[model samples]
Target chain A: MKKHETAGPTLLRQLTYRLAVFTLIFAILDVGLVVWTYTSQPEALGEQLLTLEASKLERSPFLSPDELTGPPGARSWSARAVYPARANPDHPNRSGSLMDWTRRERLEHSIRISGVRRIERGGSPEWVWMELEADSIRPYIPVILNELLTHVALPLVPLLALMLIFNVLAARRILQPLRQAEREIERLDAEKMTTRLTEPSAPREVNALVRAVNRALQRLDDTMVRLRSFTSNAAHELRTPLSIIQLSLERLPESDHRTELQLDVSQLNRLVGQMLDLTRADTMEFDTGTILDLADIGRDIVSDMTPMAYSANRELHFDDFGSAMVSGHAEAIYRIYRNLVDNAFLHAPGESPIEVSAGPGPQISVRDYGPGICEADLSNIFEPLWRKDRRRNDGAGLGLSIVKRLAEAHHGTVSVQNMNGSGALFTVHFQEGMPESGDLKQTLPS
Target chain B: MRLLLIEDSKRLASLIRDGLQDQGFAVDWCETLNEVKLLRQLVQYDLLLLDLGLPDGDGLSLVRSMRRREDTTPILIITAHGELDDRVVGLDAGADDYLCKPFQLPELVSRCRALLRRPGASLSTVLSAGNVLFDSSTRALLVSGNLVDATAREINLLEHLLRRTGQVVPRPVLENSLYSMENAVTPNALEASVSRLRKRLKMAAANVQIRTVHGVGYVLFEPK
Candidate 1:
C-alpha cells in the first residue's frame, strides 16, 4: 500500500525531475544510435571502398588508382581488373557484372565486394573492383561519442537548462495570484472578515477556490454582524427597564431589602453597559490618526471614579510621569483604564489605595493591594463571563474582557500578573506615534 | 426653578420628574423633541433635561439646533450610552453635562443643580456644600450660618471647590479660576491660597474640608 503524501514536491522540483528524465532518455537514444553505427561500420566501409575504386578507374584507368583503404581501422583494400566482353571472348566475367565478382570475392576473402565497372583508357576499356578487410572499428567509438556530444548532448544541456529556468518562472507567474490570495487569507481575522480575496485573473481552479473562500467569509461576516447588533440592541433595550427599576427603588422607603435590590439593579446596569461596550469594541471603526495623551485619560478616570472610591472607603490615585501620547480612540483607552480600576476596587482592601499610573511611554497600569490572583485563574480572568466565584453577584466578570478587547482594538495589549507582595497589577501598552493618513483610512471599516 | 425633561420611556420620565419635583423644582415632562420646541416657546424653563434617545428624533439634533439659535439655556443630557465618545459628542453639541441612565436620584439631582448653578443660570448666587456657604454676589463666606473671614483669593478657591463639591478639581482648573492668565502668579500661590482657606475653614469648624488628592488636585467633602 502506498503511504498518503501530505505534501508533494514543489512545482519547480517536479519540472526539473521531468526535464532530467527527458534528457536521460534522449542521451540513451543518442548513445544507442552511435553504438549501432559503430557495430555496422565494416559492411558500410567495404561498399564505399568498392564504389571509390570503380569511380577512380573510370576517371583515369591508366593512372595508378589511389590506394583503396577505409577509415583508420581498415586493415587494407585491394583492387582487381577484369576483361571487357569485346576485348576477351569466353571471359569468365561479363563486363560490368556484379554477380561474378560477388561470387569470387565471397569465396576468397570472408567479405564480399560487388562493384564492376568498365573504364576506357587510351582507346582500351577494362573493369575494376575493390574489397576492404579490417579487424575492428573500435577506434571510431570516441569520435562518434564526441560528435554526438558536440552536436546533440552539448546543445541539449543548455537548452534543457533554459527550459528549466523558463518553466520555473512561468510556474511562478501562473501561481502569483495564489500567493497573493495566501497573503490575503493570512491577514483575515474577526475584524477583517469582511475583506474578500479578489483575483479574477487567476486560473480557473484557483479562482474557484478563492470564490468558495470568499463566500465562506461572507457568511461569517453576516453572522458576526447579526451577533453584534443583537448584543447592542439587547443592551439598549435593557437600559430603560433598568432605569425604571433604579428610579422606583430610589423612591421606596429606606430598607435593607430595597438597598440590596438597588445594588442588584446597578450591577445589572453595569453588565448591560459592558455588553454594549464589548459589542462596540468588536465593531467600532475608529480613526487612528487622533492623538490623545494617556496621562490625561488616566486623570479623567481617576477623577471620575474618585467619588465612588471614596464612598466605598477606598482611594483612587493617578500618577503621571509625563505626557504619554498615543494614537487611538480616546474613549477606548479611557475604558481600558476605567475597567481595570473597577476590577481593582472589587478585589483590593478598602483602606489600600488603588494606584493608576500612565506615562514614560504609551502605557497605563492599575495596581491593587490585595490577595493576588490565583496562578490557575490568571489565564482565564480575561475571558468574558468567567468568574473566580461564580455565585458572587458583585461583578458580571465582563470588565476585564472588555478591557482586553478595547486594548486590542487600538492595536494595544493588556496583561495581568501577581505583584511582588499580595497584589495584582494590570497593564496596557498601546502603539505609539501617529499613523499616516493612508494607515488611518485602512483602520477604518470598509 | 422650573425644568423640562425630554425622554422616550414613559415610566423613566415620570420617575425622573417626580424625583426632581421632590428636590424642590417645578418639573414638566415630554417624550419628544417637537413638544420640547413647543414648550420652550410657551414657558421659560430655567433648565432643559434632554434625553439623547427621544421618540421623534435624536435629542442631539435638538441640542445642536438650539445652540445654533444662540440660545443660552443650559441643557443636561441624560443618556443610556455612557461611553466617553457619547459624552464628548453630547457636550460638543452644546449640552452642559451628561448623566447616564440607571443613576441614583441624588446623583441626577446633583448634576441638574450643578448645571443650573453656573454663572448665568437661574440658580441662586449662593453655593453651599455641607454646612459651608459662599455668596458669589457678596463674596461672603459663612460656616454653619455664621460669617467667617476669608481673603479674596481664598474666597475664589472656595467657590471653585464648592462648585464640584465631592469631585476632584484638577489643579490647573483651580489655578485658572483663581488667577487671571495674564497675572505673573507664583507657582505656589494657589497652593498657598488653598492652605489658608483650609486653615480658616478649620478654625471656623466648617463641616466641609478641602483635601488634597496628592499630585492631582483638591476635593471638598463633608467630613464623616
Candidate 2:
C-alpha cells in the first residue's frame, strides 16, 4: 500500500457529484420563481391602478380619456382599461390569465389591465403587462433588466450562491475528521501499528467511534503479545522434548524395530516443526525477506542435498545465467529450497539426473528426470496437505504448499509443469520489489 | 557451564534437565519466574534459558527487569515460532540469542557454545565458513589461505555477513553495521566499499552472484 497515494475514490468525484445535485435544484427554483413573479406582477399592479382610476372617475363624474393616457405597454409596467360599456370593446374581459401573452390573450380573455401606478396624479408605477391594448391606456418605457437579473431574480441568485458556498463549508467540516483518520490509518503499516491515531476534534458521535477504534487496536496489541508468548513457549516445549526423544532413541540398541522407531520419531518431529511454522507465519508480515542470490540459494540447497542424491546414484547439476537476486526470508526461503530439493530426491529414480539453474530476473528451475506429475494433478499440487502420490504415504503434502505460500509472500511465484520429454520442472520467479532487488548483481562466491 | 532453565511443565522440565545435565551443563531447573528470580538473587549463572510461559510471569518482562538490574548473563529465548516479529525487541531487552522449537539437540548445544564463546577479546581468532576466513579483531579477510586487505567498513560488513554465514544478511542491516549512527557512514560510502569488497570476493570463483533485490535490500550469497 503506497502511504501517500490515494487508492480508491478521488475527492474530485465526490465534489462533482455533490455540486451537480446542488446546481440542478438551484437552477429549477431560480427559473420557477422568476416566472411566477413576472406573471403575478401585472395582477398586483392592475388592482392598485384600477382602484385609483375608479376613484378619479367617481370624483370627476366624467373623467376624460386623457386622464388615463399614461405611458404603459413597453416596460415592466403596462396599462389597459376596462370600462363597463364605456371602455374600449377590445379590452380584456377578465375570463383567463390577467396577462396571458406579450400583448394579447394566449387564453380567451381580451381586456387585461396592468398598472404600475400610484394613487397620486404623478408617480412611477412598479410593474405591469397587458393582454390587450385599450383606448384610454398607454404603454410607457421604463427600466428593464437582464432576463437573468430581474426583480424576481434579485434574491434567488444570491440565495443559490449562498447555498453553494455554505454547503462547501459544511461538507468540508463534516469530512475533515474522516479524512484525517484515513491518513492516520494509512500510515499504520505493520512497522508502525504501535502508534495510535490522534483523537479527532469531531462531534460527540464521531468521537465515540474514534474511541472504539482505538480500543480495537489496543485489543489487537494485547492479543499479539499473547500470541508471541505462546509461540515462544511452544518452540521451547517442543525442542527440548524432541531432543530428549532423539537422545533416548540413540541410547537404544541398533535393530530393525529401533530403526523403524527412529524414522517414526523423526517424522513426528518434522510434523511438529511444521506446525510451529504455521503459528509463526502470522508474525512474519513485517519480515521483508533477505535479498537472495538465486544461484546461491540453488547451489547451497542442491549441494546440501547432494549426498542424498548421490547415494541414490542420481546426478545433480546446476547452471547459472550469472547472478540473479530475489527477495526472500532467509530461513523460510532456505526451507523452501530444502523442501523442493528434498522432494526432487524423493521422486527422481535412482541414477536419474537433476538440474538446477538461476539467473538475473531471478528464476530457479529445478528439473528431475522422474515420472512427471500427472497433468490432472498440476493445479492441485500446491494445495496444503494434498498429495499426488497415493501409493507413497511417506509424508504430509505440505512441501509444495509451503513453497507456494512462501513464494507469494515474498512477492514471487512458483509453478510446476511437465517438461517436453521427461520429468517435472519446478520454477520459482521473483518479481521486482522482492525484499531487496535493486542494485546491480555482483558475482562472487564468498 | 552453569545455566538456569525456567519452564512450566514438570514432566518436560525433568526430561530436559536430565538431558542437559548429561550434555555437561550444570543445570538449575525452575518451573516459575519466582524460583528463577530467587535463584538469581542468590547466585549468578553464566547463561539463562527462559521459557516465555513460566507460570508466574511474562518471560520477556523478566528478561527486561534483569537487564534493568544490570545483570549481564547471556539470555537465550526458546520460542516455538521459527519467525519472530521483532528481533530488536528481544535484542533490546537483553536476550543474546533465539532458538525455535523442535530443533536438533546438537544444534542447541552448538548455539550455546557459540554464545558463550562470543565475548572473548582475541584478535588472533579467525571465523572460518567453508574455505573463507575472516578475523574479527584484526579485520583480516582470507579466501583459501590468502590474506586480503579489506577496508574497515568492508571488514565490518564482511564480518557481519559471515556471522550469519549460509544465511541471508539484509543489505540495509549490513549497511547499518557499516554505517550506523555510531559510525557516521553514508550509503554511498558503504556502496563504494561493497563494490571494492565484491571485487576482492569475486577473485575466488565465477557464476557466484551477489544479487540485488530490487527496491528492498542486498544479501551475500555463498554457493556451496
Candidate 3:
C-alpha cells in the first residue's frame, strides 16, 4: 500500500520563503542608504566651501593684503590669482568680472577642479580663484560601499543560515504530532474500529481535524457495534430453529427421506457457516504474533479433509517442505486453505487429485486438474456472492471472498489463475518476518 | 447426569432439553441467568448449558460469578453468537466447551460427553464417541445401542484411545494403558490389539475411526 502524502503548502516552507524575502529587502534598503550618503557628500562639501570663502571675502574685502596671501595648495581646495578680464564667457557675472569655472585640464590628470572667483577690491579688481579638487578625496563612495557590505550584509549570511537550521528543527517539532497521527490512522483497521486517534497536540487547525476524525471514528464504532450485535442475535435466532429441526431429525428412524432431510439441513448449515465466516473475514484481526508453518497447516487441513476427499473418490496430495513459517492467525490461515481446497473439490471434477504445496517464500498453493475457470469469471471470482455458473447450488459464492479477506487480514494476498490447458491454481503469499519462536502459537498442539 | 440450561428462546431451550433427555440426562431449562443463579444454589448441576443473550442478564456474567464462587460444574456455552471472539471469551471465562447455535444434535451430545469425561469430572469413567459407548464400571462395550463382544485387551485399547478422542496418543502411552507396568509387552503387542479393536469397531459399524500415524501414534474421532 502506498503511504499517504502530506500534500498542499507546508507551514515551514511558507515561513522560510517569507523570511528570506524580508531579509533580502532589508539588505537592499541598507545598501541604498549607504550609497546615497556617500555620493552626496562631495556636493555638500563644495557648497560649504563656497559659503565659507564668500563670508571671508565679505568680512575682509581683499583690501587687507594679508588675507590675499592666505593658505594655498590645500589638500582638497586651492586658491590662485586671475585677472577679471580673463573670465570665460560662460561665467554668470561677466559684467562684474567674477565667475565660476570647471577646469577641463584637471580631468585628464585625474583631478576635477571647481573654481569660484572673488574680485580683489584694493587694486584693479583682480579675481581670487578658489578651486576644490574632487578626485583628490580618493573615491569615498566605493570605500564606504565596501565597508557597508562587509560589516552589514556579510553577517546576514550566517544569520540566514542559522534561521534556516532553526526553521528545519522547528518544522519537524511542529509536525511531530501530525506524523504520529498519520501512523495511528494508518494502523486503524476494521477490527480496530474502537481505537481512536490520540488527540494530536498540534496547531488549532490540525487539532480541529483530529477532533473531527475522532468523532467520525466514534460514529463508525457505534455503528459497527450495533451491526455486530444484531448479526450475532440474528445468527442465534436463525440457528435456534435449525438446531431444533436437526435435533428432531436426529430422533427419527433411519429412512431415505430422513437422510435427504439431513443433507438439506447440512447444506443450510454450511451456508450459514460460510455467511458467518464472511462476516468474520471482514472484521477479524490477525494476531501476527502467532506464526505457523504453512506446510504444517496444509498437512493438518489435508488430514482433516481426507475423509471427505476419499468419499468423493478424490486424493489429497500434500507436498510439505517442513517449515514454511508465516506470521498469522492459525485459524484464519487454516480457513483460507480449507476454502481453497473445498472450492477445488466442488468445482474441479471428481477423481482428480488435489495438489497442495508450500515453499520458503512463505507461500502456499493449491492446484486442481479440473475444467479451468472461464477467463471472464476469473476477476470476479473473489467478489462476494459471485459465481461462474449460478446453477451450481452448492455454495452461496462467499468462499473465495472470505479467503481473500482472511489473507489480507494477515497481510498476505491470494491470487488465482488458470493453468496451462487445464485446471486452476490458487496461491497465497504471506509477508515475510521472523518473530521469536515462542511468540508464535503452534499450528497443531502436541 | 443433570444439566441447567439457560436460554432466552423457549423453543430452542425446549428442543435442546429434549435432545439431552433422550441422551439420558436430566435437563432443567430456564429462560434467564437469574433463574439459573437461583436454581443453581438449590441444586448442584453436573453441567451448565449457557446461552449468552439471556432475557434477564448475560449468561457470561453468571458463568463468571459461578467460577468466582468456586463452582466446578462444567459450562458448555451454546449461543447464537458463533464469532471467534465470543467463543474465546466464553472459554476464557471458565466455560468447559463452546458450541455455536444450530449445531448438530449428535455433535452437541458428543461435546457434552467429552466435557463430562474430563479427568476430574464426575462422569470420567464412561467413555463414549459417536454412537459407541464403553462403560468401565459395567465392563460393557455398546455400539449403536447394541452390545458388542470384545476381548478385555481390546476394550482396554479402545478405552485408552477414547479417553483422548481426536488427539494423537503416543504409542508408549497406549502400550502402557493396554498393559500394567509389571507385564512385559511384546514388540507388536499394542499394534495387534489396535488392529483387532479396529476390525471389531468396523464390524459393529461404529461411527468412529482409528487413524495410525506411522511414527507418532493413534487418533480416534467420529468421521463426519
Residues A1-446, model 2: lDDT tens digits: 45465477655556656766876687678667655664467543344344444345345534443454433552232344333323335656622223222323223323444332222223411212222343322331121233335453576657656766677678778878877777677766442246677787777666777778888888887887687667656655676677557656655778999888777777776666655555454344535445767777666666455534534656567677765776655566666676677678778777877777776567777788888999788889888778877777656776777777666666568988888888888988776644333443321111
How big is the positional error of residue A207 in model 3, measured in Å on the Cα after superposition?
3.9
Which candidate leads in lDDT?
A: 1
Which residue pairs show backbone clashes in model 3?
Answer: A236-B80
- Candidate 3: lDDT of B6? 85
Regions of candidate 1 where Cα sits further than 4 Å from its true position: A1-6, A19-159, A374-378, A433-446, B180-186, B222-224
Give the winner by TM-score: 1 or 2: 1
What is the number of residue pairs that collide in model 3?
Answer: 1
The complex in candidate 3 yields a DockQ of 0.28
Worst 10 residues of 3 chain B by lDDT: B212-221
- Angstrom error of the Cα, residue B25, model 3: value is 6.2
lDDT of 1 by residue, A207-250 (tens): 99899989999899999999888888888778878999999998
Q: Which residue pairs in candidate 1 collide?
A: none
Off by over 4 Å in 3: A1-39, A43-191, A194-209, A224-233, A241-393, A396-446, B1-5, B18-28, B33-48, B56-75, B88-96, B109-155, B158-224
Give lDDT: candidate 1, residue B155.
84
Candidate 3 per-residue lDDT, tens place, A1-446, comes to: 35666677777778789878988898888878766765576554444444445446656653442244322333455566665555566667776555654342345545444555564455545555665555444433335545576766788888987888788888788777787778778877767577788886667767888889999999999999888766655655678788778877887999999999988887787677777777777656435556678877777677666656655767777776555887777777788888899899888886998888787568898999999788788789999999877887778888899889888776678888899988999999887767667465322111
